[model samples]
Target: MRCFEHPSQKRLLRFISPIACLISFMVTDLVTAEEAWLTRSQQLLNTLQGQAKPAWLENNPHQLEARQQVLELFNTSKPLTDLKFGTEQSPMGKNGQPLKMLFISFSLGETTLKGIFEEASGRDDVLLVFRGPKPSQKLPALMGDLKRLLKGIDPVPNIVIDPTRFQRWSVASVPDIVVEQDRKSRLHVRGVSSLSWLDEQIKAGKQGDLGTLGDVGEIAEIDLLEEIKRRMAAIDWKQKQQQAIARFWAQQKFEDLPTAQADRDRSVDLTITAPRDLSAPNGQRIIRAGQTVNPLDKMPFGLCLMVFDATVPAQVELIQHHSCQDKKARVLYLASSMPRQDGWDSLKRLETTLQAPVYLLTPDVRIRFQLQHVPAIVEQVGKHLVVHERKVRASQGAPS
Candidate 1:
């Protein structure tokens, strides 16, 4: 029995109650700390995985930063600063994290495979491991097959295509099962078996072969790792990169903005009425429907938005005269429009000249600030947003 709950400690219970409360508080704080650390760790891991996934998939020229992140995510990586993955690197976690792994190879004709997939569906502790993709089928085909198998199944089976696990646990055949818990291998059934049966055997202190799968359909003829390497080697990365850049330009939405005929300044009332009642955590009505809320009343306007047409040379010169200097305020440059033929060069030049990043003005931002003319500066003053439209003449500033 626990010492605090023991008959011998009954008399001392009163004395230790306060101490127990303190210990409970400590445990609560520790759990909170652990959760915070876990969140941080997950964020870092996701960043590492995210960078690698996109750059690798998009066929970009090279992702040095993504490679570096991958290196940081792993322990015992060589040359600390090197971005490229080394050939002769010793990885950390060679034994693998303790897990219930179900080994399977992708095939067009594995009938029992569908059943196994369904049985393992939505299970957190169990994972379906594939040796590699099917020889005749591409990666997309494997995904499609899985899609068909787990159709309408919520929280589908977790899967991975890594031969390293097969090598580690000596998983020679498909549909085999292994149970690992508490950082140790408990049971490994190298043959056809169900997760439930394998679990039962492991619990009952039983060990032996559960028979093997018959000569079913075509097993994955290709090694997934080798196929991946081959595909990467065959790709025309230069053409892929050119296509990416072309797509970027095609997606640009640079709208036309009429030049300002006359200089004028206007204030836009940012007050908005709530559509419904907004309540506090205690169910108290903080704001009723149709009540106005001025954001400026609660928070200071801290950003100076500068909007101009990048296509117009004179307007560009007009923006240069104004450094957008505001005390303790951030400056944001939004381009009204850019020539599609030379948008990249124009954006780069604007950024270089202003020593700041320039963003394309979206319809939402234009509508949000109620912008009607080019070469305008939007600033927050008091409870209102002031849009200062600078009139550009045919010579002094920019032409219409």
Candidate 2:
């Protein structure tokens, strides 16, 4: 080297010194950082392991006894303490007078019951009474029989079942009638009688003796002309109702959309569609083509869309209880169709209790999720919607 070093060797020596230094420094830094991370991780793991576990309740004889006691209490019958009888205000008759009471029994022959109901039919003032035990299980069958007897009546008579009232008035026979003057004065018939014979008796009692009898009026006869007019009015009212429903369905934009399924994660971009305003600002929307979207951007908040049939109440209740776990997601309840008035009323009560928003299932929503059966849950994951057909087990307290 003293004789004269080569220029290439000198250049190589200068470059190699810095490169080696850089390599050594990088290796040392990596080793130090890795050691520090390992130490911190070990400390965290030890801390977690040292923490005390939560105390959990274990099954015991005392718990079992308490549960059995609770079940026994629930199984006991609760007597009606504040029961009142005959407090219902009678509806007004066509003559603007309060209707009279006609008490009868199911034990009466079918022909006799039909005859009495036919006479009492179409009279708003005539309240029909059927004597029976408190209707706990046999109410539906009794109502079915009554409806069959009053088949063609324009306005079916208001029938009440009151075993207590029957006992109070000393009604001991199958076919009986009770004529009342105001709420105080009452006349009780204890044997089978025709409507005409009852009318005659009521007239005789009104005229002959206010001492023995009271100011009871005769039962009004059914006016055929008035009945025809009422039938026409009912038809007109039904037509109006149907038209209103038609108008409601026509205004819905997504009524005819075909149902589709989204059982997996995927993007659903609209290639030739226009943007529209959504109900919620944070809600998912149809992504338009040519719109730039960041793949790494965080997804919008998910929704728990529960589709259910109003008919399956137990299953719906189970779903409602279970779906509360997803606290971050909003719940939207949708019924399969417009149910009967009673079912709709029940849904309204449930909506109030749950404090959740509910809607009717439109074709658009049903088709979008391709929902076959309900109750079902629809939720969003990444860019796609996941439709889950939740099966309710009989063991889960859902009705089989």
For all predictions, the C-alpha RMSD in Å is 18.1, 28.2
lDDT per residue for candidate 1 within 288-333, as digits (tens), equals 8888777566555556877899888888877767654466666767
Q: Once superposed on the true structure, which residue ranges of model 1 sit more than 4 Å away at CA?
A: 1-220, 236-242, 276-289, 323-329, 397-400
**What digit string (tens of lDDT, one per residue) describes model 2 on residues 1-400?**
0112323224323433322233233223222332343343233334423343211111233334445533432321111111121123334533534346666665555686787767765555566665532224244455566667766654454566554445555554545566655543345654534656666767776422223222222222222223334444454333443343344335434222222222333233311222332222345443444444432132332346666665566556756665533567666666664344443345456667556545556553455456666666666655555666656565556322
Worst 10 residues of 2 by lDDT: 76-85
* Deviation in Å, model 2, residue 286 alpha carbon: 15
- Give the top-scoring candidate (lDDT): 1
Scored by TM-score, the top model is 1
Colliding residue pairs in candidate 1: none
User: What is the C-alpha local distance difference test score of each model?
Assistant: 0.59, 0.46
